[model samples]
Target: MPGLAASVNTPFYQQHWQQIHLPLLKQRQTELWVCHLQCRVPAIAGNKWLKLKYHIQHIQQYEKTGILTFGGAFSNHLAAVAAAGKAFGFQTHAIVRHDGAVLNPTLAACQEQDMQLSFVSPQQYRQRQQSGYLATLQQQFPDWLLVPEGGTSPLGVKGVAELQLNNTPAGAADLICCATGSGGTVAGLALGHPQTAVLGINVVKDPSLPEQITALAPHQHNWQLAADCSGLRYGQFDAATLQLCLQLSQQDLPLEPVYTGKALQTLLAALREGHIKTGQRLVFFHTGGLQGLDGMLQRQRITQEQYQQIKSAELRLWHQFG
Candidate 1:
């Protein structure tokens, strides 16, 4: 873990998962234990760290020159890559969607981390896996290890499976829930905690999300998905969604709508729908995406005031309601 080496500024610890008992959960029959991975490291924290852990090691194993990965405008994955590259001595390249040289906060931060920016149109990025497309990139960036979008390789799965919960009050979790983007996080969780039933909240409406999870990690213990909780579609957020994000942020679980926020919303909705039975202990994985908030505000997915409110919530306190 050279990236998270014993540096004074490293917010992440060797112990990746921290169990926090929300005061609100005690009121209900169901118990909620949140594993806060969002603030795992000073930068490049959260579930992305779990996803990219082995990839970085792969780069070291192969003695690769650099890493090239794919992402959207405000991709937390790319930001994590940039941060990781900075901490480690590897070059980073991002094949991002949107055909512009705009130095948005995310991209700018990547640039600061010395990640080379490569802009591709949405259509071209969509064809990223189409035979000649990848071949061309291989030819152009020879010697570069191309990490798949969201860094969801088998090695990545192996890396994420290493993340375990500590300080478990009553031991194992009855249910583990996470936001499903590329299905890597849930796949890793399923593989790691086979005894626990895992639920994935679809942040991106992919009809084939389950299939993707199956492909990444073949398992039979339990892999369930909860859909229609992403505020209509991917990268879109509503006022209520923003409010929930703020609420969670005030509780020390900062999240953005693209990933973590949607998962929380889905969990609450599941509770309301009676999907979560009483007396069951739930462990929710807080996949980080604080870097995406600026992009969300810029795109008007969330208002400026809403973002500010989330940032300035020191006075807000959590109260348990019965």
Candidate 2:
């Protein structure tokens, strides 16, 4: 990232784009607007950018030179941290929640970004929040700024709050929807726009998700969390989820299970169950997780070649990373 080609510019901050005329949007009869946050930055796009938006600012604000964060093998947060550290001139290290030697595309890509990897047992990873655990890390890497798992710091909420909803769908949205990871994005969004109902479709089966997001939100805004539509749970999908992923990908809406797909499935199920009113406009945020797709495919025992053969129709545009 440091001395990268000039023509290969990836901006840390850029203007958001609004896309319209997608077929399903019309059929839904809603003023649907999607912030193509994926295109905002090539590496740290979508909620990853928002999550790290203020973390980077915090590091710079404190005049730090190193960063430390936590994640699993397929963590989007870890990937973003690695990319941000390389692009913005910081030493980055990832405390991965895995044991033994693990070689995968996500970690490989992080290495390509010049991120240092440290493998830890799942139990140790869970101790990330304990005072003594953090103190040990502080003693080990005294200069590195420690970021929580999923980058869900209070600063992260502030970064997500900076996202301004465009006037195009400004007052028209009856329900603003997004996929929840660390719950920072939804908290920031709900705090930023308190009037609209925020329906956050959670990927994991955690029951405390709502309380967690509510506690993080600066304001107790109108919001709801849907945990029922988890389809085969996080990182595990069934025939229905695969079908939905295929359907959305064919429409140029790439998704991964940990976030986007579950949100989409929840929304569609809501519409089908008549939980949403006929005239209500549902603004779905496409929080990009294309980076995790290949990892999920491999975890499902499908090779990249097999996925390519299946999505041949959508391959051309896939190169664009849309």
Candidate 3:
């Protein structure tokens, strides 16, 4: 309850853009509205807070000591759980997929939040979803609530469903879009706004994701998934996507390349390809993971100039809204 209370008090803002110089959107006569969820704990911004808040409430209700979760070395989910734990007074532990010998900026941030980390081989990490493996984890950490990777469980979906993304400044959005990694956010949107269509740009190549989303919101049929346009691996992004993120930042929208940028790129591509129809309002949830830019910079996935450009935009937006 303390965690939920703390997060509920944080300010949230929405920025709508209809004047971008994109010919595709103009030709389609579509408007894009972005909901930027600002959290007191920066890492828990955007969908992270929406996904994790109910999990924290559940642990508190059941009198659990803390949370034990799984993620890759630079996972935004892990960073979010760590920050939420620190902000709300819960112990945190993570089973991380091994990426390299050293800690990246994301992992370093997790440690700063006092999140206990245990690295595992990729093969072992894949077993996280198995019932037997989950049983073992429960036996090992009996007092901690075991949250699914990316917080994609029912509780996570429930938390995300509380968002009112359909109600834009002008009117209700005809379509709601988000970058779907684990499917929880899109599922929540579909469940929350049964009248509006929800399109999730699948950032990962996992074939089972659609099925996973269906399982999460079985009665909801208003949602669909589209593959990422880049055709690159989940963590790997192309230069064009990076360029789009930079361009949008100048318009006062700070987007990171991994999820938000790739999603907007795919959405714009859909508009160009005539997949999205004309004269509709679209609300894209800027599910924040801008902190991952630091990890990207540390791994040389982005240049110093690119990092500074994005960071400067983020600082400006935060100064105005945060």
Candidate 4:
């Protein structure tokens, strides 16, 4: 398999899933493992680095000036790209979707990384997929490589397919799961692990997600999408989801509610509802968005106490490998 070059500097780590919070996991005899791709730059941790890996390579290979992408003001994708641009020596720009350009922690980090920001209204943002708008962007920034929002391009899927998540210390997983946003990661997983079942716990309530995944990994039929248990909108989490994130932190698996926590909550709901088979090995990809905690706290979505609790868990988890 073509893997990420050594220079990207992402180290892989696996942690056996341990959380008594979900009692059904024990009753079902399901072995769960969590895998992380730890990047020194932090924002590129988890699926971010893998998804952006090839995009960066394309820029370098083709001699493109930098990366031009689209995202919301608090988007993890934008943060990752900005950090990547700074760490890897490239310029970065983002077409941000928002009625007002508030300097949230995520956008602030992008600026700190020297990423240029251009705010667009939600109506204008909706035109991102239109060919006319894309052509205009191409004409405006001729030297820049325009990446899709959430990094779900063909090259992004190619990069994500290089991840080896089926292997655990115990054995190979019968099923693999991840928090699916733009479908690239799940699609890539299906392409990479054709023998295993891939489940995407969709954080958004988009009925078109399965079709999106299908479009990305057209040759593979090993993947499916499941709705989030809370049925919350993208970037929104309920109180129960917040509590679950705090509870899981006790097991040293830090997760943000918008993606990872919500997805795992849905997965646990499935296991408890008898949707998952017993005696099967499952591996969950921890798609990191810990950087979003600062934004969550700033937006008052999570209390300062909750933020400290979850952030501490992340600190301890990383220190173990240090």
Candidate 5:
């Protein structure tokens, strides 16, 4: 099967103190208010069950289809491709970055989805967009169909555009926010609807993102990019960001520390600064990454004593109120 891991977890709304904490924080802010919009990506196998059923159906219509290849060891794209391959009877190959020494949760989930994984050097990985690299792979697996990394090809973008169009609320919103790893989702959303403004918060700390996004969308002007420099290093947490993540999660808007936490911070800051006006409805798109939170929390150096104190304080507060 060429799709995301079956064991891969999805995020759900749960009752937690973090959810409660956020509303209090919002109350502190005189200008900014928060609103959340939920959207679902394709399942592990790159199959958009609702819209892309026809495409999957078409793949099934062809008997000679062999393999589907894409990028990201821990990518939802990999999981989706793997699932699609397994369900539609196509071979799946995941070309991953060489530096990924240990299998992260997402990768583990992808493996569970039954995708064959291959690692390549960082230099070779850079050549992923080149025709020569793809040519070599095609020569090796003559019948394989190459799907670009993050599924950013025309077909993929089309399906993504449809998803964005369908999920966007009926009325006007001040901003539609999402975390951008590959620019595909943002690009598709930008293309589908021109009326609303789309803001992408980059989890990756690349300074060149503005140029990169512009290259991907040269003519589009309504799109904006907000980089999460708080997590200066990838997969590493900063104290302030972790605290914010913990607080936001308590607010009924549980945000993953890496991407959404930074986004929430940016959104709130924008609201406080009057960047976005009051009564201007904003919609935040939550791209799922709950597994990453566990990895981040595990890396924290907090001692048992510190954890106990925090827990004790929280319990005392609850008891006083209740």
Candidate 6:
């Protein structure tokens, strides 16, 4: 692991194997293909199902294990961490943002997974990597093993690096695309595939992200950022974009109105603009966000009736065509 400074959890791999990766490998048999999954938190859930089972089993062999701590209120990371903790008999602590008093859906999910929730002011939460802050928490929970937020550390990157192992579809993939929030997943991918170009589709409007990515993996080139804002504020969505998200969701590739949807939009736009040329394989990482779909649909005022109608029509059309 190149970035993790803490004791990393391994149960996520098992969860991902069961939920996402195995199905993906089974369904997708093309030589040259595209992956729309990004580095969203749920992506970790899928990864957990696909890969972490063995690691969990191995960790069980060792004694003197400690609790794993990570994440914020709305974070799918928190949910995954919580689930992983419960399954592995490790105590879990979640550091959540102090935006509000109420727990978000993800935090509630974490609660169900038996993760203890702790709230810190947004500013203090931002200082998570600071020595003073971490030291205080370390002192408080001496037995707790820390995991970096969003799991962007060296150990986390090690988990992500598994994506590149024994998983190529056949022909050379010209480009690998992902959405970068903390930059660890892309960093791991870049490290794993030095020859293939890695493209990051940023959902946030962070001007410093390119430099951040470069800093994370200085030795790796052929990685660049695609600046397509799509008029979304971070974690916020617009009408047209929400429509696109709904459309994509209807296509069985459910995407949230946040990062993954924007990344998908960027990828499609790149294809239209000739940036992602035909015959050049593009793999868009479909980082998981099925949970976020609830918030997105709620915010967009998308009704269940409408969803049923649309799905029904699409199914009918598909049946007719097939």
Top model number, TM-score: 3
TM-score of 1: 0.87
Local accuracy of candidate 4 as per-residue lDDT tens digits, 1-322: 1233336534433333332335677789987788877676677888888889888888878888899999988899999999888877888999999857479999999999999999988999999989999999999999999999999989999988988876687788888999988899999999999999999988866677788888889889889888899987898889889888999998788988999999888888888888998988888898898899999999888999999999999988888767
Predicted candidate 1 versus true structure: per-residue lDDT over 1-322, tens digit per residue: 4644324233343433334455445545777777754434446666877877777777777788889999887788899999888776789999999756367888888899999988889998987657788888889989888888888878778777777742456677888888888888888888888778889888788777788789888755577888846457887767677678787766655667767777887787777667788777788877767778777677666778877776554123111210
> Which lDDT values do the candidates have, in the order given?
0.74, 0.72, 0.87, 0.85, 0.55, 0.59
Report the lDDT tens digits of candidate 2 across residue range 79-194: 88888888777889999989553678789889998899999998888898789999999889987899988888788887777776634434557787888877888888888777
Name the runs in model 6 displaced over 4 angstroms. 1-44, 47-70, 165-170, 297-302, 305-322
Per-residue alpha-carbon lDDT of candidate 5 for residues 10-128, written as tens digits (9 for 90 to 100): 32122112113245235543222333322233243112221223234444555435445555444555655555556555566788876755776566766766777888888878887
Give candidate 2 regions above 4 Å deviation: 2-28, 38-41, 99-101, 169-171, 300-306, 309-322
Q: Which ten residues in a row have the lowest lDDT in candidate 5?
A: 11-20
Stretches > 4 Å off in candidate 5: 1-73, 87-89, 164-170, 206-219, 229-231, 294-322
Question: What is the C-alpha lDDT profile of model 6 across 108-163, one tens digit per residue?
Answer: 67788778887888887888878898899888877566766666665566556657
TM-score of each: 0.87, 0.86, 0.94, 0.94, 0.70, 0.75
RMSD of each: 4.4, 3.7, 2.3, 3.2, 7.3, 7.6
lDDT of predicted model 2: 0.72
Model 6: ten consecutive residues of lowest lDDT: 13-22
TM-score-best of 4 and 5: 4
Ranking by lDDT: 3, 4, 1, 2, 6, 5
Candidate 1 Cα outliers beyond 4 Å, as residue runs: 1-28, 38-41, 99-101, 300-304, 312-322
Task: Kindly report which residue pairs in candidate 2 clash with one another.
Answer: none
Query: Whose lDDT is greatest here?
Result: 3
Give me the displacement of residue 92 in model 3, in angstroms.
0.4
Error of 4 at 217 (Å): 0.8
